[model samples]
Target: MARLSGLFLCGALLSFACQDLGIAVEVKVPAEPLSTPVGKNAELPCSYSTSVGDSFALEWSFVPPGKPLSASHPILYFTNGRVYPTGSQAKRASLLQNPPTRGVATLKLIDAHPSDTGTYLCQVNNPPDFYTNGLGLINLTVLVPPSSPLCSKSGQTSVGGSAALKCSSSQGAPRPVYNWVRLGSSPTPSPGSMVQDEVSGQLILTNLSLTYSGTYRCVATNQMGSASCELTLSVTDPSKGRVAGALIGVLLGVLLLSVAAFCLIRFQKDRRKRPKETYGGSDIREDAIAPGISEHTSMRPDSSKGLLEKPSSASSVTTTKSKLPMVV
Candidate 1:
């Protein structure tokens, strides 16, 4: 009975030892995130430890940022001892390890874009060696340099007023940070006078004074690079501007009034120079009398000659009448 018990204990111990030695495959990747500039190549390191078999397979996949791991798409695959790049990344991606069955399944991606910023999954599979999880995850960031910022200003910047200046860059992957600087010698001109919003890239000036007027620059910076733009601020006296505007308005009003008066005066002078046409009864009577007086003067000369010749006829008639009365 003692010999039988000793054999049973040995068998039990040997079985437990064999079970412990049957651990499964495990995968490892970099713990820290990887970063690279846009249009550059990025390497995703991956490794695994297991009893590799003749039918080993490795797969590389990607999931965009803010997406679930299950949504990842295959980037490359290794089967039959050959690497096959798949999906949109096929032309730009390749295996770093030639065989990939040696537990190294690193991937090299060329010409990465800003849209490639996401998590990458490396999976290894070998039948009968899958006791453990055979997966690894790596986070990648693709950096884009900032383009030149567009600077703008709003609100009244005159003395004793407020003004807001804004700056922005549209072409940056991770949103660019902004910094505003006034190009002058006065450092910290007034505490709390200038306020800045880092995220929105807005600078506000309160109780604006002439000292705040100068060349201002806005700089946008990101992990990749920086860009900047400049603008000049000119402070004017509000009273002077209003006075000048009032003067211009007054001059324009005077000019319009002068033009109207000149037109009216020219119309009056033209009316005075034109001759008036008369069509009254007195004008017609005067025209008729002028011809009648001319006719009477011409007939008076003939009447006087007739009167002088009528005296001879009157004497002959009186002598004949006296001879008739004596014969009776």
Candidate 2:
């Protein structure tokens, strides 16, 4: 029992000394890059040399390609015999070995996405053993096929004008290269008449003619796969278009004149059919105002003349019996 006690005291002293002196940590990772298709799993291998320590900790972080290390985003952490996940990758990232005390600190990623293609850092810390080589870097690439391209046209499609046809793919890994081809036999283009940019997928046609009118197909290809799109370009003569527009205008003018003539003719016919509007006074100025007054007014006044002779009896009687028409 006394010897065991002495041995325990020596061991305690040695452990304290080792902690103060510190041991260099060695971490290993693959030098070559690792690749996985999108939506697949990836294993980022990481290993370290160190005794299991109570103060041991493991961290996995990611930095997008072309970015500085300061942009590291934490994926997960392993400490105190528990796993604590962090960031968007928390649900997909995990340690290959639980309780990584056995030295393997490999990182496993499930359902890898295209956005996960970047640089990953695996770091191990065992207290005083963090003096050197405690971290490693890994490059991950997620393969993706080219998506369907969008085909479009720009500028004028009329003859003797400039025009452009464009094609592009919105999604692809390793960037897709574009190629343009006319579907059918095309006339040989004159020097400097046509220009095509494969990188930007733009086909420029200057001094366009009827020959340029055809179906064009663009193919985008990459390491994964290829996708294609098509567009139809129609060239026309501006003079013909102007003539058609003039003809349409003349037709519209004729239609408007016909409508106006029809309206005028209808107005005259309706006026002829309508009875004239008149008032009661119109009849008063006629030969006789009322039926009963006609006989009495027809009787001439007495032929005998006097210095101040009044109207004859027949005229007076006719005026008295006549009924005036009521005005509305």
lDDT of 2 by residue, 6-57 (tens): 9999999987776566565778999999988889899999998876678999
Cα lDDT tens digits, model 1, 194-225, are 99887899999888887888989999998888
Colliding pairs, model 2: none
**TM-score to native of every candidate shown:** 0.66, 0.63
For model 1 the TM-score comes to 0.66
Q: Pick the candidate with the highest TM-score.
A: 1
What's model 2's overall lDDT? 0.87
Show model 2 residue runs off by greater than 4 Å. 1-22, 188-192, 240-328
- Cα displacement (Å) at residue 278, model 2: 37
- Model 1: lDDT to the true structure: 0.84
lDDT of each: 0.84, 0.87
